[model samples]
Target chain A: MVDRHLFGLGLRKPHYGAFLDGAEPVPVDFVEVISENFMVEGGRPLDVLRRVRARHPVALHGVSMSIGSADGIDVDYLRRLRALVDAVEPLFVSDHLSWSRIGGFNAHDLLPLPYTGDALAVVCANIDRAQEALGRTMLVENPSSYIHLPGEMPEWEFLDMICRRTGCALLLDVNNIIVSASNHGFDATAYLAGIPAARVRQIHLAGHSQGRALLIDTHDRPVPPSVWSLYAAALERFGPVATMIERDDDIPPLAELLDELALARDIASDRERRAA
Target chain B: MTLRALQHGFRDWLTSESGPLAGRYPAGLAVYLNTYRAQLMACLSDSYPMLVAWLGEAAFAAAAATHIDGSPPHGWTLDAYALDFPVTLDGLYPEDPEVAELARLECGLGLAFVGPDAAAVDPSRLGNVDWEAAALHLAPTFRLLPATTNAAAIWSALAAGERPPPAERLPQAASIAIWRQGFTPLFRTLEAEEGEALALIRAGHGFGALCAALVERLGEEHGPARAGAFLGRWLGDGLIVDVN
Candidate 1:
């Protein structure tokens, strides 16, 4: 979500050597890293991240922010993340639209939140606290949920309300929409249509698996045709957002991911052609 | 339900099976349970890879399950989940002392790998210091752990992808020193006297008192020489960060 069309990949361990070599660039406009992985006191992890930042623009994506915690936000977490943000000066800083911590116990997974007015207030307040502490706006990604708690609004309405209330942005995950739509029996297109397109600054494309009775967001494989199709739809709506292919497990070589990013470029090119 | 009550319901479902959330959302609850346990187990496996290799997968998995059942994660980060695993290993293998010792060594090395960064004092700068009054400040990452078995040797072998030796106790008391050097985590065994000396320094004892203790143990002739030798080793190892 810089001012131009952009494509990238989630930096993982398997491709560290390729990305850090610095002889030839990894063909990414920017590389997104899990902020917590590099948020250490000091060591090779931070050293490698600094080296990579020197090569390409970076994005700080987090998993444990727990923005919708009913109890409150963790100020300690915000302080550490702020330090990393200042160091990297990344293009975008993001976490999921979910809560993981409550009453001193951290679930460590993105737990679902009801889209009721109360939950909306909690998320907005937490996001406000985070943005103020970070001294910059943050993007909150839509999470793929398995269970739907009793709520008054849909997930898109909730996201729109959050951006309006906190002056934040959005990192729309295409695969999460596909998975959640299929799991909860909602319309994916309708879900996309409801989001505020102007506020979406980034897009996450990944793969999922079929659970016994629901779809799970297991980012362990290549992006599927369904996800690609949804990505095309999302691009059409959100217009050339910063898109990336995220493969967390069973990570292929750097070459394979680049080929995937190339496909994203092709898709975006195709969209622009139609617009013309 | 109120958001607080709803979260507590989710917590009960994850920590224990007896909760209203489970009955209402059986299929979804199953998915979460599996993911929670699997992620915690994977964390233990990652943090203690050597221990997993030493204990083999099945035994390590069982021990991890017990720990997860009793210790719900409290820290915001998953790395803290590995902190209490060594204690769990102790309870599970009371007679097999090597198992827990190996876990302790691995965990300590992991901590030092990301501990605070400090620049070791240059050896050439030692001549200007007033030795009697100087308090030798060790590296912030420096950690001394008790050792009753040959866990350090076992760790080395496993890291090199070689077959580890049978677990055995040492003839005398010992400890292991873990710290980082130039972005690499390093460890070495410490003799009983050296371990006591380092512990004293860590507890804020000055170099003069350390020499006096050494002199009291070994006669006046060798005591000062031994103290000087210890200082040289510590300096050479990049363990002493400052002297004041």
Candidate 2:
């Protein structure tokens, strides 16, 4: 089980110096470190990460493990990733539930999965393997997809099956659910309703940019109001999961992000308080 | 499709120029793949800005597209995607040593940024070692590049997002040292003699062997004194690590 933090924000390089200086620690209860950014040797990123870890709890979010790929997990990558986890001792570790590689080549993007029975088995096995390697429970985040595969079951059913089989927790990104559902013409509420409340461990709130007809999870802008409303709906259903705001590009000042995160914290708290 | 077949099909769609895979995917899937390619190219362009500016966006984009097609990212992290970019660019820009050298330096910086962190040994620990006989172990993030052009200057300027002046006639030979001292990555252009000494030391040559290489390269007339002075400066600069 993960700690119930009211809100967290994705750590970025722009805020590294301020974080080291202990300038603004009030806005977030925790921060999410992109695992690869600080994996490198003796540098500012690592130094800042150490400082941040000292001040607040961190969660390591990784992009590359390609857990759903048929070619098997990259052992070398895992070793490095494990070494990082040891160094940071994050609150929890997580990766996308999609594959980013095939036949030794990486697309560097979270490629969509076919969502078939075979993919389910492969993903569950990979999650089991990853948890065993890390010696800890892992959370699998739902990826924002612009494309759907032919064999994929409904996204929610897939997540349900994966968590049921592997005992891994889910990091449900509300924005992703909304975006993918809108793109695919599925009911976002139905998608949210399908996720087992007991299995959800974390929540991600990020802004998405619109492509010609679909929403792209660019993480460059502020969290859209519609997504925020959907998050409220998720809280009503899932009951105040650990939520974080992820802004990766055109990032605003730390205060601005915290303002956004504070809103989430308030929303989650209000819902929890109401339930009580 | 079987998992393997599905993977192969996806790989083909991502890499090859063919559009038939577009038909295979569900409606609107092709748009996603195209968007994926564009976003990836944007990232590659941002990461290798100097290289892109030097090669011009069109040519650089073509090269990046080719590189992506040839070696799609395997890790979720894009930080290490262009690790072999310099070698590939070297093949493409054989006559432009500046381009190749700049790519190497840029890649080195990127690697230092993302490579595994090692605790830097405090210089105070070196007081116990015999400086004259000790072989130096450069930090795990240390990288040395010998180049035939003024690429280091160009790279540094580009890193600062400054436009470099036109390459004034290429230099005979030069070298650059890149390493993470503390948490900040530092790069410096090294003289031929300094580069050779550091190279020998990195190759596990003892202090005596480094002097020998310096003497062999620069001759005895001024080699010993120059090498000794350079070693002192390197130690002060935090460039040399005590291996013993």
Highest lDDT: give the candidate number: 1
Q: On a 0 to 100 scale, what is the lDDT of residue B81 in model 2?
A: 68
TM-score leader: 1
Q: Estimate each model's TM-score.
A: 0.98, 0.90
Model 2 lDDT tens row, B95-139? 777887888887787777655566555666666777567777677
In the range B130-164, model 1's lDDT, one tens digit per residue, is: 99998999989999999999999999999999999
Regions more than 4 Å wrong, model 2: A2-5, B17-20, B25-27, B53-59, B69-71, B74-76, B114-132, B156-165, B168-171, B213-223
- How many residue-pair clashes does candidate 1 contain? 0
Looking at candidate 1 chain B, the ten consecutive residues that score lowest on lDDT are: B17-26
Error of 1 at A189 (Å): 0.5
Give each model's whole-structure lDDT: 0.92, 0.79
How many backbone clashes does every candidate have? 0, 14
* CAPRI-style docking class of model 1 based on DockQ: medium
**How much is A194 displaced in model 1, in angstroms?**
0.3
